[model samples]
Target: MLDIKFIRENVDLVKRVVKNKQLDISIVDSVLKIDEKKRKLIGEVEELRGLKNKYASEKNIEKGKETKLKLQELEPRLSEVEKEFLAAIYKIPNIVSSDTPIGKDESENKVIRSWGTPKEFKFTPKDHLELGTKLGIIDTELAGRVVGTRFTYLFGDAVLLQNSLYQFALEVLLKKGFIPVLPPLFINPDVYTKMARLSPETEIERYAIERDNQYLIGSAEHTLGPMHMGETLNEKALPLRYFAFTPAFRREAGSYGKDTKGILRQHQFDKLEMESFSTPEQGLVEQDFFVSIQEELMQALEIPYQVVAICTGDMGGPDFRQMDIESWMPGQGKYRETHTSDYMTDYQSRRLNTRVKTKNGVEFVHMNDATAFAMGRTIIAILENYQNEDGSINVPSVLQKWMGKSKIQTK
Candidate 1:
């Protein structure tokens, strides 16, 4: 959530951000009005409490009783107003960086650069689904029958490939000083709310274990981010980096009839996510470094991909700036999103109460989360890019050691 003081001082600018993000502009007015009322009520409550204490000290029982009654009346209202104020303020999105494009949606996202060239296949390239089926490595049809759509079972080399992806990413991140963690798959609703990704508006995108009062995490960062919630870190730990491997669950709500045939859009998928907390001044640079690591991983796989700067409306409310890596999918005849890096600045830290003690004072730390690899999508990219004419899939050279075979073919 944005600091209320910042919102008050830059009302116009905040409103512009709301408009650019395609949110209700009137939320600014609502939040300001509620803040004014809340502050007034707080003052009245404090004043009444002071009077009650003063009267009691002076042995004026009747006056003290009246003041106490007034306090009781106002305190409940103050509590209500405070809740209302928080709800309103949380609606305000983080201000986007000046360099971020001010466009409405993904269509307006700018492609910053690209790496590698899409291979020219000698035969008609098969999509990952067809290749996986022919190789007897992926079975969505059986998974769908057992668990419904957007689910799949990986057999044989496909499972090995996924594990290899995780191992490769973990090694890369470990050498870069990132601590690897296996975070909880479930999160308390309150903590999840403070993470600010799953709001009342987007809660449907996540799985809720209603009985347990917990929500299944849609990403590893969801759990990794709040590790130091409500704590202050020493400034010397300026950039605390971590990478987590977890099975992510998503409802895929409202995403029907899209990528319905493959593991590209699944209800359950494994991912390796990179998350970090840094001093404010180093936030943007930290994000760039994360993107660089993402590029390094993709390049090592020899997959052609482009870097895209996500437009305002295309990014999440907590993202001050966002970028994605879209790898070339020859089977799909287009580039598809395989990795994303988000620089949330202090937007998330402010809510999580995750702060850093600096030379000056304690302040909210900036947060960043990016994809090391979304196993399913990366696998799709590899399958399509490295498929042989006779329906075999050559493993990426880097993963060959782990797989112990250069190619995977039908038994």
Candidate 2:
């Protein structure tokens, strides 16, 4: 949620940014109206409460029957006003950064730059689905029968390939001074929504449990983000680094038809996420650290990729600035996003109530998060790029030891 005060000051800018994100502006208008009503109620409620207190403290209690009645009359109204204020606060979206580009969808998104040319194949390249099945690495149909669509069973050497990604990502992140954490797998909506990078339009992506207050985490960033919730930390610990590995879940709603054929997207998948906390004084530096780790991971895996700065319209409120690492997929004949790095610049910490107290006093900490690795997507990238005509995958030199072979040969 955005601070009502900030929204009040930046209504025009908020309206424009909302348009760029391809979001509904009507809700934003309603929020502003609700905010106005709440503000008026606060002043009115405070005045009535002060008068009630004054009346109660007056002398000559035998003559105070009229005062008692007036105080009782004001109580219900004050309660009603507080309820409205709380509701308005919950609906407010965080203020987006000023630099966001004005556009709708990825087509409108500006490409800052790209890296590493797409690999040229001497032979016709096979898509991941064809390559994986032929290599005896992925069994989508059987797994779909056992569970459902969008689920897969990794066979042959795929398991080792997936494990190898986690091993490599964790090592690189740790060397960057990131503390490895195993966060809680589930969290209540109050905390989840508090730091989550979700919006009203994207609500379908979230998986909420009807039976309980908890929801399965979509990303480790959710847990890592609220770690300092409602707490103040020392200034010296300004840039706190953390890396986590977990099986992330999503409802995958609204994305019904796209990428349903392969593990390009899935409901449950493993990922290595990196999160950082820094003071306003050191936010960009912390952001660079995250970007560096993403690049380092790609280089170590020997994958060709490009880095692009996301336009303001492409980013949500929790992210003040964003960048994506897109890997080359020769089979797909194009680059696709595999990792994203974000600089949230106090947006999340403020909402989650995570603050730091320096010599100058308390302030919200800026947050940064990046995808160090997603096991399934990484596997897909590897299978497509490293596939051989004989249904084999030449393991990257870095991961050869982990797979226990130089190549994965289909039986």
Candidate 3:
């Protein structure tokens, strides 16, 4: 959410951003109108409060009663106006950075650079889904019977491979001074709403356990973000970095028939995610650092990949800037997105009330969240890229130690 004052002062600029982000500009206008009414009501209420104070001080019962009555009526009106103002403003998106590219969708995203070369296979390479099935490692049919579609049951070596991916990512993040956390997988709707833009418009994208009145986390960031909710931190704790490995759930709502064959788009998957709270000036640097870390991890795994800058319409609502890491899938014969990093400069903190108190003053802390490894996608990348002609999957050199074997072959 943007500051209403900033929106009011820069209406034209805000309107331009709204259009660029493909949001409704009328939301800005609505907020301004509500803000104006709210301010007017506040002034009237303050005057009435002053008069009531004066009447009481002078022992004038009649005027004091009348003033109190006026305040009672005006205060409720002020509350309603304030609610309207907040509702309108919350719909507005964060101001995009000037350097952010302008594009309509992911198709228009700019590729910054690529690393490694896609492997050339003398024999046809099998997709991960086929390889997993042949090796008895992944079963979607069983998952469908057990749960529903868009789910997978990782068997034998596949489970070990995912664990290896998690440990490998943990080693990299730990070296960078990130604290490891196992956040709650279930978050109350209120906290989730404040940490994320979970309006009725996009609520279908989330999974809610109606019986428990809680929502399962779509990503570890959703849980990590609210750790400091409504709390103030010391300046020395700036740039607090955290990483979590958790099972993330999503409804995959409205995404039918897309990547439906494999673990690429699943109802439940494990992910190692990184979240950071930094001083305003350090937010972008922290995000860049995360991107570098992601690149390093991918390079270590020896996967061919590219980094792409997300455009306005494709970026998330709270993102000031976003970047995605796409890994080469040999079976697909293309690069598919495996990771994304978002720099939400104080956009989430403002609503979470996660702040830092310095000698200068207090202000909302900037936040960045990025994927270290979406384990299922990482598994796909590894399986497809490292497959041998005989249908065995070679483990990345870095993960071989934990995986206990160089290659996984059918039993």
Q: After aligning candidate 3 to the native by TM-score, how far in Å is the CA of 8 from where it should be?
A: 1.2
Best by TM-score: 1
The predicted structure with the larger TM-score, 2 or 3, is 3
User: Higher-TM-score candidate among 1 and 3?
Assistant: 1
Per-residue lDDT of candidate 2, residues 81-161 (tens digit)? 666665555554455545555555565666665655566777898988888887777889998999898888887688888
Choose 1 or 3, whichever is better by lDDT. Answer: 1
Tell me the tens digit of each residue's lDDT in model 3 across 151-233. 99999999999888888888888888999999999989888878865777778988889999998899999999999999999
lDDT score at residue 340, model 3, on the 0-100 scale: 97
TM-score of 3: 0.98
By lDDT, the better pick of 1 and 2 is 1
TM-score for each model: 0.99, 0.91, 0.98
Best by lDDT: 1
Score each candidate by Cα lDDT: 0.93, 0.77, 0.91
Order of all candidates by TM-score, from best down to worst? 1, 3, 2
- Please identify model 3 stretches exceeding 4 Å from their true place: none
